[model samples]
Target: MNNIFVYCEVTEERSIADVSLELLSKGRKLADDLKVKLEAVVMGHKVTKLEALLYPFGVDVIHYADDEKLFPYTTLPHTAVIIELFKKEQPGIVLFGATSIGRDLAPRVASALRCGLTADCTSLEIGDHFDNKTQTEYKNLLYQIRPAFGGNIIATIINPETRPQMATVREGVMKKEVYSVKYKGKLNKIDAKSILKDDDFAVTIIERHLEKSKIDIKNAQVVIAGGYGVGSKENFQLLFDLAEVLGAQVGASRAAVDAGFAEHERQVGQTGVTVRPKLYIACGISGAVQHRAGMDQSAQIISINTDINAPISHIADYTITGNVADVIPRMIKYYKKNSK
Candidate 1:
């Protein structure tokens, strides 16, 4: 375990994706544990100029593969470049953010490399110690923990025999390292690929359109989300009232979102945006691991549900047992009464 490599999937505008920094933070810890260098790999058109943004995260190396063919993120060509880099670096641990691009790219890279890759890992650790160091075989070691059975259990997966142990983690699950104005690191520019572009694959992205939301839940400071237990779509209006009072955005669980109670952008879970807001109010939302995977990193979590035994109640910093519709009106009344 000499090197920890992270994928820096960026937008065309040169803005580094948040998930990349999250990976760097997790990678920094793993690198320190294994006494290795942490490297950030950026592949896109004219990406070499963005190296200044990466060094502040405390990454040791920045490998930029600036190629025209990689700008739009095609499958075969991008996968080919990543495979070439992995073969050359042979890093001990490789991490990709469980984003739209990562979800598609990671598998291809892993398949090309012929190694095991765990997807949507919520927790990661390194330097796992064995009970019998000398007598125990080196095969059954190294733990990768993820939520299973709808987030009821934390399953620790192991891939001892694989080189470059790979995993894809959701954004915001790990903290982002703060930037330093004076920090400096090395960057290397990769030459253009010898082969020209070929669009022979069955899948090619035709167009991408950004959704228009009243408020961007991903970057919202405060989020008030509800679930099926919120009663009905009409009852869910209380969530918005509370959100307005608190200057917060509204979010919903997959169950509620899929049922047309809320829009997809407001949904928070493994399938939705990973948010680390200052405060998250989970109203009537059960503490499913999938939902927790998105907002567990919020600075403060307030759970409101009638059932004290609800799974989310245990993880919340504050819990109130009452109907969402009932408790919400009380909350609105309290907030309004306290206001001057």
Candidate 2:
């Protein structure tokens, strides 16, 4: 009830995961709203240069648990550490990255403590809730919002009676920002032996191999996206051409992927990678709510579709009414002409 805690995940490269940094950025704002300190729990082996990495995100205190067994992130060891620390701290809110590790660890911790845990939350906000059944008014509850009912409606969930309301958020959903470069925070080192047991080390990693994806649209500054309306796999080449001309990445809606117009990695929507590019160009996209949830945060959005009344037009800064075949090449030519 005193602080907001973010469970920071460590990458294979021994750096903090991007999602953890993003959570810290969001946690800082939530902590400010609740008038509480933003704390981070970082567990890894030989992890160094943390203050240089985390403090500027407005973290007030850090629980650094360093041990050789912690780096690889086993379910039992990580869960035991978090549960032990949480029992001692009794945090007001706890956040985790909706990653493989988070998916494995958060539920265990929540079950151990009997706390409510929300997963893949698209948004987090602090608000008041009134329980009509109990006639009770609760203040400053974490609103865990996500697409529900087959992505038809957005649901806002709350844990009014649970201690340390917890939620796991997807990467790229929240923007990562720096609070202040000069800000500093305190660190509390935890001894692994006191908190861990022989059972915690029941699972051991003999070897680990990582395969990185070639497509990285999440960090693209400019994105050119297409939908089922893009017509065919051959027509999607126009998006790639336009992207090439503008130095942008090519993205596709789930429909386009389902129709085999693009690779699965290139899909952008609730079920795909979320992006916040400087510029987003949607070609022949109908713009469903799920798709909008992913790229609506882009700095500027341009929708190109024959349907002028399409849902995407509502959020697009500019909407072009035309066929994708006709509009895309002209856009490519215009940008290529201007750049030269």
Candidate 3:
């Protein structure tokens, strides 16, 4: 209960990932509630420069492991560094972003330490629970909340017995905020060379191809999502047109993705990426429970569907009853005319 640690993932651009900062922002609140310090575990080669970014996000101390072998994120060395740090520090709560690297590393470390790990958590909080069976009270437990049963129900998981409660949160599930300038923190450099050995690296990365992605729906300020009602792959262009006018990204429900109307990466739902955009325009989507679980957290929802009784209408801030093809062109025209 001394410190809350966040595993900061460094990008190939030598910058800290946005998800890491988001975790730190949430971890800060948890640390405050627990009266503990908020710490971050940063690992990469020449990553000392990125420490400055961690300070504003409520990080009190940084456990840094800077080494060439740490870059590109091989499982063994990175896991070794994290495991060694956990053994030495014994942090209270450890958080990881449910990204590719986080998903891979968290389970390994949790298994090694014989601790419990909650994956794809949407929300986290500190609270107490009364065990009626034991007639016992557990205080200050980390509540790992996530969608369960194919997003039909929500489940809150707790690791009451574990020393360092661990959870992997999907990106964009939490908001990122910076503390006031009055707050400042310190960093502690770790020697990873001594802890790692030649045999530890069972796998090697001969070459790495970093492809720049075209769509970043998770971080988009405005997202326009389509479903089966959008019709065919060619008709999906209507979504793109609206998105271009709004300076937004295009997203699709699992149905649209599966029907070949959109690429899998453009999917937004339980089986796909979760988004909490400022404005979510769900066009032609029925708002299935699975899709709702991903985007129901948006600040504002505008659902457009011909069916007045569409499930999305229940959660939508504004419901437009119309065909997407007919409605979208008019919207684009109105925006273009008004802006001019």
Candidate 4:
């Protein structure tokens, strides 16, 4: 019998990915529900250093696969490593962070393993089940639930026919486990094989640049997102002012970004950053499925739009129906007066 496996996408220095730790936190509950042990599976050069952090996150075991060949994040090599691990470990459930790398690697791994995978899943729980004569006592019985059809309905997916039930969950939807010094677990260094050759993949890294920011939107405590309704690039300054007063980062909708009002990096949609801030203030943006995919995980959503019927208003915890140009200034005034 295989254990529940969570993929730990390590950074260049071998620190665990934030989303990977979140998966372990979620996986820990799922493993307990199914009466199984939670295991962390890491792949990269010198990944053994990560094992010490997994136990505090409730992992019962850590499987380390270290190879200099696995240093870079490439689709073919990373997917090949995960596929090889699956064959050897035979885990019943596998969880991946729905990051750029995970999005690329997961589909290939799922294809190689011939299994089903749920992507950008916001919510996951063990599915309801009925006893089946053929259903293994501990396998393929849990249903994977996630938001679908633009958060209008919930879809429950089951891979009853497959060995390992796989899923890629969006970052920030699940909480990360804090390091606890009290809990301790075992770490095992595994001998893993490199299944891909240099020529097997056509992609190569020529140069890499990472955008460093003082405030990361995904980890921000407060976010103010501008929508198409913000009107023009100059008008975005008002939203930025509000963000500054509230100490929040600015986010943009796909429409706003495409209109040249903002950079694509600031867009909040399926194609942009997935954020779950404590407070998400949507100004003048109509809620589209793609837009909601990124910000719906926020702890509290407040929308200000001219159209009360805008799709985003429906999901907001509080809705103020009015033009952003008119509404935002009033809010700024009110906040300043009461914020003594």
| Top model number, lDDT | 2
TM-score of each: 0.88, 0.90, 0.91, 0.85
Cα lDDT listed for each candidate: 0.81, 0.92, 0.89, 0.81
Off by over 4 Å in 1: 129-136, 139-142, 179-181, 195-205, 211-214, 274-278, 297-300
User: Which residue pairs collide in model 1, if any?
Assistant: none
Model 1 per-residue lDDT tens digits across residues 1-340: 3488999987757667888888898887777677788899887876534766788777788888887667777777777777777787898788998877899988988887777788888788864544464554553233678878867787887766677788998776778875465667788766646533455244677897754346588888999999988878999898999988988899999999978898887889876777889999999998788898888889999999888998898779999988898888888898899998
Q: Which residue window of length 10 is worst by lDDT in model 3?
A: 47-56
* Runs off by more than 4 Å, candidate 3: 218-221, 269-278, 297-299, 333-339
Model 3: lDDT equals 0.89
Candidate 4 structure quality by residue, lDDT tens digits, 1-340:
5578988897755688888999999998888788888998887887544756788888888877777766667777777667777898799888899887788888888888999998877667775554478665544355776767755776778887686888888666678865465667787776645466776467887888765445467777898999989999988988888988888899999889989988776877665778888999999888887688788888999999888899998799999988788888888899999998
Off by over 4 Å in 4: 129-140, 150-152, 192-202, 213-215, 258-260, 264-278, 288-301, 314-317
C-alpha root-mean-square deviation, candidate 4: 3.3
Model 3, span 1-340: residue lDDT tens: 4489999999988888888988999999999899999999999988646656888888889888888888879899998999989998999899999888999999999999999999988789999999999898999999998778866688999987777899998777778899754567887999999999997799998988887677799889999999998998887999999999999999999899989999988888765778988999999999887788789989999988999999899999999999999899998999899995
Lowest summed lDDT window (length 10), candidate 2: 331-340
